[model samples]
Target: MEKMKLKLLYADLQSDIRVIEKELETALDSSSHYLKDASLHLLKAGGKRIRPVFVLLGAKFGQYNIDDMKNVAVPLELIHMASLVHDDVIDDAELRRGRPTVKSQWNNRVAMYAGDFIFARALEYMTNIQNEKAHQILSKTMVEIVQGEIIQIEDKMHLNQSIRDYFRRIKRKTALLISSSCQLGAVAAGADDSVAHHLKKFGYYVGMSFQIIDDVLDLTATDKQLGKPAGSDLLQGNITLPVLLAKNDSAIRPYIEKALSGDMKEDERQVFLKKMRSSNAINEAYHISNLYLQKALKEIEELPANSVKKSLKDIALYMGKRKF
Candidate 1:
């Protein structure tokens, strides 16, 4: 019943995602050959499109104008894409969703220029809306998001960090952009302040849950499913929730410490990953994410009941249950 229920929620947004894909290509159309090609490479690679869909769905609760709503949706996706390009460079990530990342396909200089270019383009595109609140919300989110990345870098390899620190970092790194997505969508469509606030909270909670699940899958899911090695986060020295939780287990402590403290040979890395999978840590982390999903659903339920609201609720559930 739970699995069937989540499928139905995702079904609601499938068509909307198709519409957004077309709009995104149009948005990436640019005169500069290098920028256009680079941006298109990333755009065409595709994503869950969760942020733009949230923006569009939140808009429907108010005025329901696709044209006016698209102004916000496109830039929201562009902002997200811009961040991804930069993130790949910072993480030195070679792949995303099974394809070579921008930095991997091109070079770091191109990735940086491409990210900056798309960010400028996002601002240019969004200016059509003429709403000061939307700008303020998105702009502030962008700044905080960068700060969060900086904090993550600073905290990396420092395995002694607390759970509160992990939550705070993920909130800034992952949740803020998602929260802004919902907020900008509502404000662009002229929804009242209350609806925007609820959607913002909903996005924040779901974003946290979504990222926590992603971290879990980075260990539990197969390499093919993750498009990277399992336990890549730990290998990269970014302490995630499951790692934090498992480190508390006396039996699990050595594996966690060994993974964090040194250059792991292939066999050692596999042993550490196996230990994490066997521990209760992954289950405990999923429980925490489920709590956030429920909180997100509670916010969605507060909105007027409609197919869109139902779909958003379903997406929240889907994030909790996604396999990889």
Candidate 2:
């Protein structure tokens, strides 16, 4: 299966990932039982832990010290976890990775508090890193993520938004953190500036491809696969790459408008989902995603040949081809 293949690519990092996992458990510890429970709930739901993987891999390109790398890896994953908790609140999402979200399990206020608590823990861990450049990169990434989310809110349901608008939103919303993971890991391990720059670019391209493939899967995959209703993004009025490309067809425009109008029937939504799956829009979106993947590979090609570089390349390929 695709999941197993991706896991195989990073199999060498199993021990390092375990260390990061334990650190995450320790990091989420809190005196407030409520905050502790809420944060723990999200953490237990599990994820690809891709940010931490990128961090470990990036570190391999430099001095390759697990102790030095964990500082960067732990905080980045924490930031991502905190963002997911808050995003569920914003999306009013009930399920994530097939489990009830923090907000759904508790409530929105509890979720927000939990998110803030986790973010604080992230900063606490980040302080372990003395590198000023690492701090600067992470701080700016955090700000960009917030700005991206705000822009996503502002652009919601507005079909007139340009393709550039979509790209810019995703760059900050998703890509920057992954990019920072690579750069910060390299910086933490004292990699050369040129090497760090290439890894950062590699992560950026891979992240972009990952998000686009996600958007395509939103319409093409089943609810069970997504852990939420199919077409959930459309239902929530968030226009993604596939939808933006699909809207070019006059036949699809009215359906998109109806969906965006927030009055679509369940049956009609199903029809729209089907139409999108069969449309050229999906292919176009995949094409764009492949282009990004190629760029990611190109970035990897610039790095000195090593097992780390090979793993990074395999990750990029998996991102382009993953079904879930």
Candidate 3:
């Protein structure tokens, strides 16, 4: 399981991660039963906890201090959770991690309110660290992520969009936050500027690889693996690297065009997915993701040759080969 893999990768930080898990649960205590339940639902569903892992790892660059580092780790995860709640509403997603999404259980409005409340909690947690630089970095990242969401909405159904556009969007959407986690974590623990920069760059490369592989999995993985349809991204008009590459084939172009036009029927969607799974697009996407993995390794190579570097390097290798 991915959870087991993460634990193995972070074997040394097990106690710190457990502390973070407990903190996540306690952070949601609220007077409103509805808000409390909605937030708790998402928390209990379980996730890879990748952001928090990065935050903790970044802290290792400086003197490892769970107390100060947690202030950064908790909110990085809270921001990610808040984004997922809002994303479910925007995507009309019914399930997340094999359970009902907040929007599905309650409604869109409730999901929005829940997301806002969690974000507020993140800000409150952030304020606890009096570092103005950390606050500014996080604030800018929040704005960029929102802009990425808006661009995704606007670019959806536009199959001809440049590959550059797709890369930029994913960078803002996924990579920025992860990069911030590394940077902010280092800053929180008083890492030197050079160390923080390397960690931030490392996070960006790994984050890009992670999301690209996720997009690839969306096309190739089973419904059970994804906890949703395999072609959910295409069904939702979110063109990823696989879709873009597959669209160039004369044999599959029509099906892909139909998907882009928002008219893919059930059978067509299945056929499209099948053809895509067999196509070279998956291979091409993997090659690109491998590039990112290599870049990530290169960035972390500048850090001290220690267990922290070893774990980060292992995680990059794992991202390239991950199934879910």
Candidate 4:
């Protein structure tokens, strides 16, 4: 399976990842059982943990110490976790990774408080690093992420947005955090500035490709694979790469309009889904994702060839080609 392949690619870091996992568990501990449980809910559901993997791998280019690297890794993952909790509330999402979201399990107010708590924990852990550059980079990334989400909210259901708009939104929504994971990890480990720059570029490209594929999967993958309904992005009025591309066709545009207008019937939704699957839009999105993948590989090529480089390369390839 695709997940198995991704796990195999990073198998060498299993022990370090375990340490990060434990640290995450410890970080979620709180006096309020409600906040603790809400915070722990999504963490328990699990994720690819790609952010921490990038952080750890980036550290490999410098002084690879698990203790030092974990400081960066754990907080990056926590930031991502906190974002997801907030995102679910924003999206009014019922499920994440096939399980009930915190907002759904508890309430929106609880989810918001839990998100704040986790973000506080992330900031607490980030203070362990003395690297001012790392802090600056992460702080900027966090701000951009919030701005991205704000833009997404504003752009919601607006079919007139350009591809440039989509790209700008995704860069902040997803890419920056992953990019920082790579850059900060290297900086934390005392890697050269040049090395960190290259790693950061690599993560940026991979993150872009990863998100494009995720958008494609939201349209093409089965509900079981996606852990939610197919076309959820479209249903929620978030125009993704495929929808933007597909909407250029007059036939598809009207359906998307109806969906966005909040009057689409279930059958019309299926019709749109069917047309999108067979359309060139999906292929076009994949082409863009592949381009980003190639750029990521180029960034990897700039790094010194080593097992870690190979691992990063493998992960990039997986991101471009992942089925779910």
Question: Number of the top candidate by lDDT?
Answer: 4
Q: What local lDDT does model 1 show for residue 287?
A: 97
lDDT of 1 by residue, 190-253 (tens): 8889999999999999999999998999999888877888888888889999999988787777
Displacement of residue 97 (Cα, Å) in model 2 is 2.0
Rank all candidate structures by their lDDT, best first, as comma-separated numbers: 4, 2, 3, 1
Q: Quote each prediction's TM-score.
A: 0.93, 0.98, 0.97, 0.98
Candidate 4: residue pairs that collide: none
Q: Where is the poorest 10-residue window by lDDT in model 1?
A: 1-10
Q: TM-score of predicted model 3?
A: 0.97
**Structure candidate 2, residue pairs in collision:** none
Put down candidate 2 lDDT per residue, 1-324, tens digits, no spaces.
Answer: 555677788999999999999999999988998878876786777788899999999988789988878989999999999999999999998888899888998899999999998899999999999988889999999999999999999999998999999999999988899899988888898988998999999999999999999999999999888888888888798999999998878878888999888889989888888888889999999999999999999999899767788889888898888998
The per-residue C-alpha lDDT of model 3 at residue 292 equals 92
Model 2 residue 1 distance off true place after TM-score fit, in angstroms: 6.1
